[model samples]
Target: MTSAEAVPFRFFSLQVVRTRRLGPSLVRITFAGPELRDFRSDGLDQSLSLFLPHPGQDEPMVPIELGEDWWRGWMELPEDVRAVMRSYTLRELRRDADGATTEIDIDFVLHGVEPDAAVPAGPASRWAAQASAGDRVRLIGPSAADNRSIRFRPPEDTDLVLIWADETAVPAASAILESLPPGTRAVAWLEAHHAEEAQKLSVAADADLVWLVSDDGAPAAIDAVRAAQLPDAERPYVWIAGESGRMKELRRHFVNERGVDRRRVTFVGYWRQGLTEEQLREQGE
Candidate 1:
């Protein structure tokens, strides 16, 4: 799923049609595009690359016809007009009665800002915080025929599910949880800054939710996962995400301490603790 050659890509020019606040730190951005009619997803933790314009730019200027080679083309553009690309999870995919898809939702975490206090500081977060209808952005994602890049691939024998995530990965985890089959058993340890960051979850699966409010002395995501106990199951699958350092610790605990098969675990380090996305990319993280 991490390899571009493994799953093909498609580009869409989406216009912001609506914006809403999902929580104190989350904002929902709804986008519409003609190409979206052919858009499809695996429904759990689907991610896409968004090319957002700068403050003064009305729409993001991007390269075209790159297809799988798009990254190279985008990287070659001048920084001033190239636009900033950020990866985001698909929160929800809506469809109409005739099975025609409507709009897609992406939840953005307003980082470095308080609940209804002030605008977020990050480029993506700030854009989302003040997003208005008619704003246009470029997205590189999966088309209806080539959405294989989605990373929620659990084995058929998966029985017990274990998950660990921070606020940055909550939207992806929420989509995964809500899409779980009825009667499935799963345990999740989610980290957040405050209680207001917790949103209602709609899961038919038998899920035990553990919310760890991150603060002065709160347990980290890895510590929480290490301290918890998973239910009995012949085959268990783990999906852990968020900061790279914490994920590395949790991966060791599951594969070494619990004797879980490394092949059965699907882990993603969305970002590093003390590095920006640009830094992560520059170092080939």
Candidate 2:
């Protein structure tokens, strides 16, 4: 929760307080710690680096004592002893009466956890699936309210908001929807595996939501978005997140096909197909 003057990010020692099943593929875990009182974030899509322990370990092993050198120190540790780090979006944060953050929620996608899964669940997914009260973990997150890690930034002149997200980015997309000012115009397309995954989203903005469920044999993302007529907007902001391949495809559709300005489009590759997070990092993707 504390950071050096030069660094806006720091390590937080947290323990799981509870978990709720959001859907067949999503779980929401709430974490809290005394240090969390220092957590500050104004961004709806705040990014966090979570460190998790291996099975049988009591807590994640991160070299936080090294301070600014923590990353290098952690990288030098034995692979089996070092923590498993994964990126996630902060779904929500609660504040005390004094405006100090008290607790935070992170929604996890429980991919490949079913018995009939094609790929096995990775360390982070496995950990989240089994997380419970008192399960210890570490996080490297912003200590400042406004930092670069928060990516959902729409220009002040934006008149329309366009969003598309896959299951991995649903938590962030949902948060953005909830944060929009009243009467703001927004359109969002969310992709899910089953109808049960289409949770009710609350928003003050005048939004049109399209849920594409694979189980229901919904049209492909490009085709659906291409066929629809968007509301008239002079300055539109596009935000997209999901698998790397699909994200790129959508970006092209908006910029090249729809004639949206590339500068107004914000796209993030939350994950990639057929690649583990570790592998993606190793390849410097």
Candidate 3:
């Protein structure tokens, strides 16, 4: 919420225009609709709530209106009819030369959900794995005129940038990297479960990217962040996202071990190792 201006949340009905497999685990779903023109996404780490349909359901159920009290209205709906709401980062946004938004891209992490799995799949991942063109869903996004969900806040006169992200945070990290101003100095350490998930990243800043594949039985993700050598600067900003426990470790390393100002570090827990997102929300995480 630091970068974008204030705007009331708006409801938009979006349909899948295409789907692409970015890697072994990342599925890029492009959504398009007339309402998308009204959706304002201020690049870095912009997130929105998606109302995805439950399994075997034909359509997503959304409230008639979005207002300041939208959560109360959503809670009033029957659980069975209500859509499965989830938070995701806006990976990319495309606009025409005339300044009209055309398409929005979201990258969904497809955690291994085998057909004969012992447990059920998460609703959002299940939807992404099986979704196709013309499939519709709903979203609570920002208005074109104003937005407030982008939370990457670098202090004035930022000199050094450091980042740590797991698979879940890769899309946001990638978008942030693309938004860096030329001559910005950055270092990113990415943790991936498999080698294929480690990707070639493009950044405008002078960045050093280290991809850590854990399937080879390497050290913990936090250890990787701890071992990396950060570029020295007068004012360094740290952005980190990953599993909850890992994020805590990285935050401590930056703030306590390295003596970085606590306010300059932004850490978000995209998920936990054992807990589901619902559980995370219930505990007020």
Candidate 4:
């Protein structure tokens, strides 16, 4: 525990305090615990590792007591026994009057959860779909306000901000928009599978938000962005996140077609279509 290795991020034991449905495909689960007093975040798109339990288990199984070796120990467990881990962005954090974090929210996309869905829901999605008060979980999150996990960084000189995100990345995009300074010029295109999946977002920036509903035959994400005209600005910053293949296409459109400086653009592939989290981890290794 004295190693300073866990200073930036550490394990937190939390329980579901409540749940709210933001849209047809989106659910917000709020968690609270004494461990949250140490949970610090600058909030815009802060990322974390969430560990959930399989059905019939009361809490996630994680060998956090192993300290820095928790990952290796957790991985050594049987696939079915080991906690199901997933990466997610912080939607928001609530604090007490003394500025101590009391509860934190994470938005989950309930993909494939419907009875008539084309595909079946994964472990995390299933758990979230049924999450209720007192359901326990584990999270490896930032203990510092400014950490590397928060990736929405726009250069100080950025005069125009552009963003594009699919359903999977709407939470991150929404958090980023809320953090922008008032009067900052930004344009964001957010894609949703159904019109009911669209949620009202709050932002201080002079941001124009466009909702692209797939059910309504909205144009392809790249095509929509490419066809729109951006306001005049000398320095522009672009951020795109979603399915890996589509994210790459948007990144290229921003860097090559839009002529935005590659250094100023931040792109993240939240998930790849046709690949499970376990499969993606295997490929990465």
Candidate 5:
């Protein structure tokens, strides 16, 4: 069946409602806006564009008009003319009692340590760390995928659902689990650099949660997840996200080795090692 065209893009002014540390390295920022009243909730796992103001800049740069043709023109513009655009997951959408206000959350992974830490620093991490309540940010998105679809309601008899991700995708993965049916049985594999970096997630009673820490070496968490055994065949749906290479590897295992139906499994490369968010976008193109 043919898919529907994307919803027209609209710019919205979002205020930072709250911020909290989810784990040692993960920070959650909740934003609310009046424009979100009509926001479509179908794109739970889909990405949105965040136009943040450059340091010291008073206003964020956003396109005056938005549409397919507008996006095409923006893409065709000189490289220098395009503003910095960051990709983030929809995470969760919550509407107020009156439905006039909506809250959307996004998680950012802290990159570096103060004077005594190891990992490198992340740009988004820094921005999130300093953002305060009432701070305004420009949001432009809810872009629909060309032929993407997901089934939230699995068969009643299905025995298991599997989810996996690293820090960058924890927000999206967690949101997905939270929206699942009350009694759905599932297993989640979350990878983190340190034990403390794993967030205490709220999942269904029937779900199994596994946290894997990467103490050393490259892609250690992915290795741990790969080495583990999946649940007994009960037609479980799998979702995996994280480092580009690791996600690609797991996608292969799910599709080629296990023969899972493509439609039942979702895989996303939230980020790649040694590359900035901008670099990842260019690579994706």
Candidate 6:
């Protein structure tokens, strides 16, 4: 909110195209927009902010302006006046050259069945749930660095690709798997709350899929991925994401014990445990 020169971010007005259940815990929402005319074709794992109105509010209140002044006003507003905002990943981006329309897709993980369950259903999810083709929602971000599509090309003679993720990161992990070149050797480990929530992903022919369920409350997926043996290769890349604590642990292990080059590995903390979107931002400060 604190306007630091208004970083020149582009805004998009998106309308929900469709929403479908991906798994027991994940839902996929597709959005189309006109501002996407020149939208960059960034593939999976990209992140953005979906701004929402305050609870019980039906419409978004755009600031007469954005930046420092807006942030100051936001801070001074009553607790209920502050709206909720959530971070989500771009699971897919499709642009129609002829139609001149672009569609962006994202997956949301349903946390629980509580009355507050509606909260994690962020602004985007909320809109996706009730919005029709013409209804609009505001979208901001896809940071400059993250705006581009992530293309992972394993070395021709590499041994294998290692992917580790939890429910929050499954969509990106699945995309990464599907993008690998044919005959690429890869191993993916995904963790979810229930076995029913595990997804059947589209991956390269040589990639092996490993699914782990939290039946006994054990963090088996992370442990399995971390404990696996890696074959020596010229250069291998590792991609890991999920809960903040788990991600941090994997990062330290790869950097210290494994001696893997930091540049060759992409580790991200999709979300932290027990922290709201606002708390997460505040803690970053």
Give the whole-model CA lDDT for all candidates, comma-separated.
Answer: 0.80, 0.90, 0.81, 0.88, 0.67, 0.66
Give candidate 3 regions above 4 Å deviation.
Answer: 1-6, 66-70, 76-78, 116-119, 144-146, 273-275, 282-285
Q: Per model, state how many residue pairs clash.
A: 0, 0, 0, 0, 1, 2
Model 4: lDDT equals 0.88
Q: What RMSD does model 3 have?
A: 3.3
Highest TM-score model number: 4
User: Per-residue error at 121 for model 1, in Å?
Assistant: 1.9
| TM-score to true structure, per model | 0.88, 0.94, 0.89, 0.95, 0.79, 0.79
If both were scored by TM-score, which would come out higher, candidate 1 or candidate 3? 3
lDDT of 5 by residue, 190-231 (tens): 777767666666665477777767763435655666676776
Model with the higher TM-score, candidate 2 or 4:
4
Candidate 2 structure quality by residue, lDDT tens digits, 1-285: 234335678888999999999888889999999989878899898888899999999999998888778878988999888999988999999999999889999999888898899989888889999999999999988888999888899999999999998888988999999999898999999988878889898889999999999899999988888988999998999999988998899999999988899999999987798886667777875
What is candidate 6's CA lDDT for residue 161?
75
lDDT of 1 at 155: 91
Compared with the true structure, what per-residue lDDT tens digits does model 6 show for residues 1-285?
433123434556576788787655567888886666534534567666676565466644545266436546655667565545677767777757574437888777765433556455544445444544554556664323333334343445556677788887888888788877787777778887777778776675588787877863745654675677766655667788888888878877777777877777778777898887778877871
| Model 6: number of backbone collisions | 2
Sort by TM-score, top down from the best: 4, 2, 3, 1, 5, 6
- lDDT-based ranking: 2, 4, 3, 1, 5, 6
The list of candidate 1 runs beyond 4 A from truth reads 1-7, 65-70, 114-120, 215-217, 282-285
Q: Which ten residues in a row have the lowest lDDT in candidate 6?
A: 142-151
lDDT of 2: 0.90
**Candidate 2: where is the Cα deviation over 4 Å?**
1-6, 282-285
Mark the 10 consecutive residues where model 2 has the least summed lDDT.
Answer: 1-10
Given candidate 5, what's the lDDT at residue 226?
65
Expressed as tens digits, the lDDT of each residue in 189-243 for candidate 3 is 8777778777776777899988877776767777777777778898999999878
